[model samples]
Target: MPLPDPSLLFRPLRKLYRRLPLPYALRVLLGRIYRRIGSPVNRAIQQRILANSLFRPPHCHLQESLDSLPDYLFWGVIDWDFRHQRPQHLAEQLSLGGRRVFYISSTLQDDPRAGFALRPLDQTGRLFEVRLFARTAPIIYHIAPDATLACQLRRSIGELLSWANTHQVVSLIQHPFWTPVAGVLPNSRVVYDCMDLHQGFGNNAVELQDLERNLIGAADLTLFASAWLEQHWHQQIPRTPAQQWAVLRNAADFDYFSKPAQHPCQAPDQGPVIGYYGALAHWFDVELLAAIAEAFPHCTILLIGADTARIGARLRHHTNVRLTGEVPYRQLSAYLHAFDVCILPFRIESLTMATNPVKVYEYLSAGKPVVTVDLPELHEFQQQVTIAKDQQAFIDAIARALQAPASSAESRQRQAFAAQQTWQHRVQALLALTEGTQQQPRVSVIVVTYNNLAFTRDCLASLTADPQGQPLEIIVVDNGSSDGSVEFLQQWATSYGQTLILNDSNRGFAAANNQGLALARGEFLALLNNDTQVTAGWARTLRRHLQRNPGLGLIGAVTNNIGNEAKIDIHYQNSQEMAVRARQYTWRHAGLIVPCATLGFFAVMMPRSTYERVGPLDEAFGLGFFEDDDYCRRVEQAGLSCAFAEDVFIHHHLSASFAQMPGKQRQLLFERNKALYEAKWGRPWTPHVAREKP
Candidate 1:
């Protein structure tokens, strides 16, 4: 017998992988491609491609964001425990602007329950800290080999946002991995911060580079810290009409660091103090520091802050060098005052090449004479400070800085420059994005149920438990539910001020939803299924996004058991797991509203105008099989866009109500509806047995 083909043997596995929920299989493919391309040149090309495709400029604005921005949610890259990078400075300033901030740390906590640890980020009592404690897929956990962690974090954050009663979350996130969560956050205005280049990612160059492109595509605004980074992204990433972004160089915290220090006078053995404070590692340029220490044996060279590697060890034994193992932030000013001159001796590698050093302005704030390496980020800082091209040039620049007057006209210019480069200004520039944006509330939910009382109960329970109490009118059209659902709904309507449409018999999905449509008063109308459980604040979230882009005619959230791109397996084993997964999914794709052709009525939200224009679901497709498609086609003809809100997740029990009917009858109706739908829309509406993702 001939040997069987290998393609047949592996085809089943490939098919199984492909069947995995929306984006999961795609992410897996990206991960595999990333692993295969080990060469740096190929990796750079891949990185460029990812940044181009993955990232996006801002697409939506918040209420009064142009006039006066509200509270913020920061998908921060740096933790306070790590470097006090741009996010920290901007968040504090934004809080000072009378807005609360929830800074999400990049470090994932080990405990799942610890995912949402709330703590005070600053003494102001306004800025809060929330951590994303995502479970890692050990062997497969290669940064974002897939959106596993992104999905996990996004879901949890969504729940947290609902529970906190925080809507209209304007966020600034750096990592492309966390961009999905930014997409899913309620009424979010996401700005993707390009602080560093892929080459600067060091060990994570490939993975982070891969994710950067998607982050660009997902963000409503893309911000580049350096012109170098902006130019590179422009060269690599293709522009979209929806992509809106700009460049803003990193600034310094002048007010906090500018005031002259009161304590810690010059060191007892100081010849001329040359101090460097920041992380000490590969970027520290140990050889240069050693060269400086050797050249100036009489001068005291101070190295402050923590060390990640053995680079600090080598500097410790130098006679002229003093390594002060990390000092409190409060004492940093004093330490700066103690230094006669400040120096940034960095390795001229890809990492340093792209860095807009946070210390440059800090040094200027102290009015200290500074010397640094030749960096593209420092091109604007010329004439005030010396830029060294090599070790010899570095030594000469430091000598020049030391020789120059500490408070000359050049020094005054430096201080003036630093004063203008404050965090307050950076934040204002950031918020300027929301200029002339209109905000409005819009959403009416219409749920249809047959006999699935259990799922209906859970759905109402979730809807009723909304923390924000955002104004939403719930209308339930009982399609002749016999399992006490109508009774429960009657009581629910009486208690909760919901609109109930009573029918004596099954009116089918189209007629029932049409019945609810007649009663809906909000700007947007949602058609939901009784057999599906809505996550907390599902209506509110859907409404926020519908308001996000007014051009959208209809929007549907992803579901646990929905078909095609909307399907996501949240690994539901229990109610807690369900909640966890739902929240994660919500936060992960919070801002990602993709233009779609078809939206299932199982849980779909559409504008009131769309319904008025396209009219209700066609009752022609009886028993509700392809009415949604026919309606969607009409919407298309009306020149309105349909979209999928990937950030929202609903738990669907998989045709629970439909499964109860006779198989032949259900099949017959489905065929009849398919025929009616195809006849009406000039396209086949058959079961998607061999279909491709749209």
Candidate 2:
């Protein structure tokens, strides 16, 4: 009657196919065919399997093991037993420092027992390996998850948190797949550990670049593995504070690699032994290896590690080269000791240019002579390591390294340099950065809302999109909305822990803002309109400029739709294009400030001291029109200047509430505000105009 679930027939075939004894090429070809033909059915079966695994209770030992230790959840990009690179090294160091770490692997398992499995990596039980059992592909390869899978993953993570009895964590995310997971974690602080230019990976889709952008925006602290990578991101997203990102380059385990190997690997006794051990993928230089083999006919070119790109075929004919595939991490030191010279022969590409190789640190730690290709990250270590500019130079460097004795003074200097660059030192620096983020200066962002709910929602979304930029204390004042804005504000305020001031009747714009200003408690205060959309790092950029100039009393951001000198002409069709244009504009005008007679109050920031000295907006200009001009005049009268930050951009939907007002009523309100402003200033009011581009 049930039609015997179609997936049941394919399960055994899938298991058998994986276990079949076949050549690497044949296995790959067969796997691709299987995936192509069975994709839809397999996805359905995987969804069913995951659905059944939810709400399962944790093991009895898990609770006791995680007790009393501060927890760190690593949304890992690789399996724990894989390459033993940055992710594994960092987790091990954190665990050694007395923190419990749960590493959720990207490699999934197929088992009927449970939805997930947790196993301790060692006896201390501080480090745990998490394996999610599923038949579908890992979520790391996709830009987003489907609705069904997303619901299951969220519920699964919730169950994990409930079992552990913790409401918050320090989430160290290594890839973009974990971005959505970080959003659902209650009050969790996110750290983005960017180790590579992910778009350069061969198997990854181009869409992952966009996902990485989202993850970077969500992270509280971003750690780049190389100076080049940090500089790359700096040019892409300009105008952020220096404290938001740091270059925590790759390092080695000094004590482990410095000691002599207990059992060294056997090598050819006659000629020199040239060695390299790491992942041999698209970036690996197989042709370079062949050239090296041909140049040194008597040398034994030992190539160790997993050949993921199937490069062994290219070098199989070389008689002197030996490929020992996929060695364990503990056995690497043995091979390093047996080598006469170590060389890194990687292709010159975008991915390899940004790589801060861990093997170089390990090779130097072992007191071996090292020669590497031209990589930007290796420039700092040119004194201790031989950096070659071309293929011929690389080969020559290797010959020189081979001639040098292992116990020379140069070897001791290399070892000394590496001792200071250990995993422990790197971990300590990382922990210090996290601690620094916790002490960020709080900023109060005040937004006054009227009847337009759609604009208000978009404004709040843009404000909170970048949680990593500046710590904000959001205060929202509602001017009696009949369009269900109050109910939405109530729920939003509760969700994000924001302050809401709900007035029973329509309060004038200046008066509503005054209410929020009175309740504000921050070193910096920003006034944002409900119809504006702000760019990332807007507040931090404005705050940095304000702090740098003591004479400046108030600052406003350049916008596309503003009436005064702060307006800048911009061209964009959509939000994504708008963000790109904003970044380009900000980078072009970085640190350039323009003194303005009057800045629009639609978006503005000032220090608390300035606010205290200049005082509040005049409520006499009822509704909205000339309160900003009045405030600017007061700031100048108090012996301070008002300026606009040229490095920041905010998008304004100009006068959303005012546009709805009747023509006669709007004109009357504007004329009344003009008279009140002119009377106070003792002169006729002149409308502001845009400044000429410098």
Candidate 3:
């Protein structure tokens, strides 16, 4: 019948393929090939098939399961079953601390029936392993996601959140693959957990490096696995706030590793066992291990973990060396009990230099003597670990470690030190940093007045108290107001103890605002038109967004009357109605933000750091026709975003000062500023239009 449908024929083939017991390695290779050759429709069909396999309970059921608990979704770098490392440890600790965690794995199941599975990882049901089934999985491990794949992943994540009715989320990103998807989650905070020098992998280095820079710039808190990584990136991206980054080194599960092995290793009859565990990747020092095997001819050298670099042939000839492939995490302690000395033999490279090995901490927890190459991170643990500079020194250190007794002072001291550096402690510090428990950030409000006495008084009165109880520093600039505005401001300043700047002549809007900006002392700065009256919690809401979204440099408030996209239709006729309308709108669109190319400066806020980087607004814009647009363009150029908070509504008596100017003069000012902006940027300006209501 018109050539049998291709999908119908392939359906049987797909079923047959799923029934076949294919090797995992082969499946992974096939998945990679499919990613390269599969059509968008085929990939989408595969994702849908996977999604259908999961047992998705009712929304209310999922909601009740995680009632009143905070959520942390980890965009994981490795699978939960893969080597239990930093990502697993952190997720486990957070879940234990009364937060529900969903760890999305990089590894994808190949079987069609294996769909997107959400497996509970702990008995408490707080920890989950989210297994995504898609052919694009292998592609993301080394490179960033393409647009199509990012859209697909975002939809999948949105679905998962909807099932749980998650309102607030903290996305803990462990790899650069998730960089493009950062800050897209609703009411979410983003954290970049930098565990490795990703560019050192040498597979798509340029793309990886670029993505990392963007991730660091956008993350609310970027955690470095080592102090060296923190300092290195700090120097690289100096524009980012110093407080935005912190060093959170890898730690071990002390109780798990410290417990004596239930079954001891069956040693080779005569000699001691010198062991090393973890991934045998490119950075692994195979040459050093070979040398150690040759030097310790009498000893048995055991290597555990997957051999990803195919270095087994090089070590096979060493009769005394043994390679025990990947072992389960629970069984690792048994091997650790048999070792006379544990070693970290890594080459001196950019990657290794930045590594803060998790195995070192685990080794110490088991009270084992440790020997490692001269990695910078080990210098702090030199007393607990032996640092060897070369192959000869490594062998010598191993010999010394073997000679030390099991219950020696150094062994006991190593255990004692590791006890204090548990994963629980690291998670506690991380929670404190992400929870915004530090001192409240100060806000400086600048109201540029030009004879709008009533509006100015209302704006000033609204600032008397802050909803968040943060210290407020109000700075009022009277730009040659002749309606007794300067006298009123002087008396108001005297009464409120606020700063005042008086101009003898009518300075342009940009100039007057710049004068106020220069005297601003708060960590956050806001430019408010004297014609607008702010609502309660307006400043706090804007500051909260800035704190939660590091990528957003400048944010403006939605108002009832504005010329740009920020203007939303309203039905309020008086101040009382206005307050009620604002409250209703805010509740309906809580935490909603609309990213825009330009944000009006009628009521805009930005951090002090952003102001410092973008500098003051262009004075050439004169009376502020295109000054906001120019500043927004500069912010975008500096790799930041501009958006308006849909939840924060202010009352604007539109253009109170500009309306007083004669029509001809106002038109002349707009034309001149438009020409200046076009000439400076070599692009035609796009005139602002009101946003269409949905």
Tens-digit lDDT track for model 2 on 1-694? 2223547768798789888899999998877887887776676665665555433554545533232234678888888988888999999999888777789888655433334667778677667887655445455675465544544454445445445544235778887776665433433456889999988887666666776887775466889999999888877765345337889999999998899899989885467899999988989988888889999988999989888887788888998888899999989999999988999999999999989999999999999999999899999799989998887888998988888876999999999999999999998998888644465567899999998999999999988886445569999999999999999999999999999999998788899999999999988999999999998678877876786688999999999998888888898998778876776566445455789999999999999998899888898888889999999999999999999987688999899989988999999999999998999999999898976777
Instruction: Give the whole-model CA lDDT for all candidates, comma-separated.
Output: 0.72, 0.81, 0.80
**Using lDDT as the measure, what is the rank order of every candidate, best first?**
2, 3, 1
Alpha-carbon RMSD of each model: 14.8, 15.2, 9.0
**lDDT for 566 (candidate 2):** 83
lDDT of 1 by residue, 481-574 (tens): 7889888989999999888988899988889988988988887788878777776557757776765577888888787676656776568787
Q: Write the per-residue lDDT of candidate 3 for residues 1-694, one digit (tens) a residue.
A: 1323436635876788788899999989877876676555675665565555543432222323333344888988788898899999999999878888889887654433323558788877678887654445655656677765555565456556555545356788988887765445544567899898887885644676788887787676889999888888978886444347788999999998888888877666577899888998898888998899888898888889899898687788888888888999988988898888999989899899998999999999999999999988889798899898788888888888888877889888999999998999999899977765434478999989999798888888767733223457889988888998988999999998989999998888899999999999999999999888787568767887897789999999999888888999888888766766775565345556899889988999999989999999889888769998899999999999999998688898888998999999999999999999999999999989889879
Model 3 misplaced stretches (Cα beyond 4 Å): 1-70, 107-117, 131-138, 146-170, 183-190, 239-242, 268-271, 436-442, 445-694
* Best candidate according to lDDT: 2
Question: How far out, in Å, is residue 195 in model 2?
Answer: 0.3
Q: Which 10-residue window in model 1 sums to the lowest lDDT?
A: 54-63
Reference-based TM-score, model 2: 0.61
Q: Is 1 or 2 the stronger prediction by lDDT?
A: 2
Comparing 2 with 3 on lDDT, the higher-scoring candidate is 2
Model 2's alpha-carbon lDDT is 0.81
TM-score each candidate: 0.61, 0.61, 0.66
